[model samples]
Target: MTVTDDPVRQQASREATRWLILLQEESDDPEISAEFDAWLAAASVNREAWAQTEKAMGLVARLSPGNTSSWCDSTGGGVDMLRQPRRRIPKRAAWTGSVVALAACVALFFTAPSLLLRLRADAMTGTAETRVLHMADGSEVTLAPGSAVSINNKDGRRSVTLLAGEALFSVVHDPAHPFVVKTGNFTTTDIGTVFDVRRTESGVDVAVRSGRVQVSGGSILAQGRELGAGGGLTASVAGFHADERSAEQVGVWADGLLVANDEPLGQVVARLKPYLSGMVIVPSHLSSQRVSGVYSLTDPGRALEAVVQARQGSVHRYSRWLTILR
Candidate 1:
């Protein structure tokens, strides 16, 4: 049997396909591009695996012009077709091949590190899946969908690195072992608190549910702000925003609902993208409009429709995976 027939190889190819799709969707982000380069440099296996997957996808594109569903399936059946030895192709059939070639080019040009980070994370949550993890030190962490974190505890120091998405942390008080969460350039150290940390494309956001926490790094206003209960801080490349909300209201995404208070449509779309399976594109004109609502994360499509409808905009869905808000 060829490599594609092997279960391990097939799984890798499936995962690689997902990464390829995501990278293409977010090609405009420079941070993602840099992270992708780092991921490619981190391991030889990653490059090899991606190359093989790309080759197989190319073969599929050449053989089957427009119907990607046949070869994009994750059941290894698509790879099986590519692996067959006797498939013949005519020299000149006026093949429609530009879209497939463009997809491959985009995938190669915009590989993301999120997939690699998820593979290496100690714990992760899949699309629309939440997980509550109990740490060895009696601490608890609730991971939002599409989130990943790696834990390390040694010599009375406990820490976790938030690789992607969001997480609500309930850190146990242990003066001897301070609990810290690292996301991007920012580091949040818990002062006996329950807090939420979300890593966005540009920066990090910290919301304290109870107790207090210290946030440092990344153009933070006033040098490592200490936020108590019901306080929050958002540190981004543009600047920072310090706000206040109820302790119970923090990390509301964990409850299957997203609460947005006068947030822009673009930001709301960005927040909802991780929960949905595929691409949700909002036009630049509609993205700047303000939106405020308690939308259900469980039904992202319906929630998006509601948000757009309020502004007299409409949502056009080409497929279950592709939705365009205009």
Candidate 2:
């Protein structure tokens, strides 16, 4: 059981753990899905607990011994088809077959989540690659590498969900047809503008490059926040905060550079993930350390080393397949 200070949170965490196991063993069942969804919708705390459980599971897989291939079920059943993904599966398909590769395969799935992302996203980009997708409604979107989005145009309105990474959106102004970008708990409705939306581990970030945007969500954004050119805001679970940046500085990652201005070390590493070939293991303490610097996305390996080194941390590259940030 997860013994948290709050009793509500503790119970939610325990239920979330149970749901996670059920998902692995019988995820294909529609009844199981409905039950899980109902449980998740029962309370806000349940959603938070589920998110934490998933995060914890990912960490466990990443740090697990590569040679050891144990999982929840000893029979090695559950989610086998999606174990290896194309873009993130580092050129090592010839490893010892099936059972023995379970640990590494599961780790890759948890980290990159290629299968789920593919199923959910209509358009996506691979490592070290960005894509410019032109919407049917004359809007333009520049997807950051390792990013994916699902676009919908219906009922005279346009909707796009940022499934992973970040994206720069240039919407065509049409009051008759609204353009909205949704990520996590927030929905950024473009009031005729170019903007950047990034889905971080903690929450969603909204930045306007030109024109204006209307951000709406729960809590701080319950009343909606309007941002004009050069305006920025970060809405995290911890709370909402103002993080303003110049128009010129927003969406710089599309230009193949990671411009970190008082950003967390983990955020910096996350931005560079698309260009990196494999997984990066960043310690919690080191990841939370504040960092500020401009790093090159074209040469992500060196950039990662620089980010970690600035905090007196070391980067250990066991192989191109894994890089550990201490």
Candidate 3:
């Protein structure tokens, strides 16, 4: 059949044939298996799409070199009666169009990884805590816990939206693709440097470390800037001026390290939540007790011991859970 002869039908046939070839070539791949399973699970339309392609291939396979030569030239399927040639289709091109379809499938299979990587590059992070991801494009992002961000690359622009929690990002030298981070009411963009951000009770907190970041009017600044090496900027929900401090104390959780530099006992307990399964309680009054030391995140026990000794506070341990206070 020519391109114009039932073009829609032919296109569907080609697509279905392509997928069949893809399935055969990637039969061993778990994803392909899953996709096929899903396809098979779907309604009859999918099956129809497959059947049409198979039919097209069947027609091609039935043609011989002489017929194929004529078929190619005629721009149509021509049946010459008197000069009939033996219908021995070329092994390479004929039959169910399987060979051609399969070749296309094989080519696509090799390229699938790269395509998937591009999709994945859009956005992903882990639980219990967020992460700082450095994309291939050099854009940096601080992923919040239980949050997924998708980066859409279109028309020389990169855009990201936080599906959950919050993220603070500092975009690096990508003038071609302006970086945009969107979270509910707040939207922030980077000029090219360092900045910290997190979702708060009201809205979101945005603080620039090196480069500047623009926080929309809807932004909810951090309660207080947790300052140090890489501290946060805490601003009141209503107030504009931010209390800037080293964000290292809270930021260290990414490495599973909870560093408290003259931090209150209560705040330290809050930092430990991401690493430990259960809660660590520091009574309201004890929360004010200052703590200064380096704790081995891998072994919270060791850090607890040092803190207790240094502050003359007591330590209570209960099945992987601990409480420390003066």
Best by lDDT: 2
Error of 1 at 119 (Å): 4.0
The best-first sequence of candidates by lDDT reads 2, 1, 3
Candidate 3 stretches with Cα past 4 Å from truth are 1-136, 142-157, 161-170, 219-232, 244-256, 304-310, 314-326
**TM-score of model number 2:** 0.67
> How badly does each model clash, as a count of residue pairs?
0, 0, 23
How many clashes (backbone atoms < 3 Å, residues ≥3 apart in a chain or on different chains) does model 3 have? 23
Model 2: worst 10 consecutive residues (lDDT sum): 59-68
Total backbone clashes of candidate 1, pairs 3 or more residues apart or in separate chains: 0
Model 1, C-alpha of 175: deviation from truth (Å) = 1.7
lDDT of each: 0.73, 0.77, 0.53
In candidate 1, how many Å is residue 163 off?
Answer: 0.8
Model 2, 216-314: lDDT tens per residue?
888767898899999999897678877668898889888878888888999788878778877788899998999998887877777887888899988
Model 2: lDDT of residue 73: 46
- Candidates in order, TM-scores: namely 0.67, 0.67, 0.46
Per-residue lDDT of candidate 3, residues 215-311 (tens digit): 5544443222222233344333475444555643344444555567788876665554444433356667666878887776666555555655566
**What would the TM-score be for candidate 1 when compared with the true structure?**
0.67
Instruction: Kindly list the per-residue Cα lDDT of model 1 for residues 237-301, writing each as its tens digit.
Output: 67888999778889888888888788899888888877776577888889999988889888876
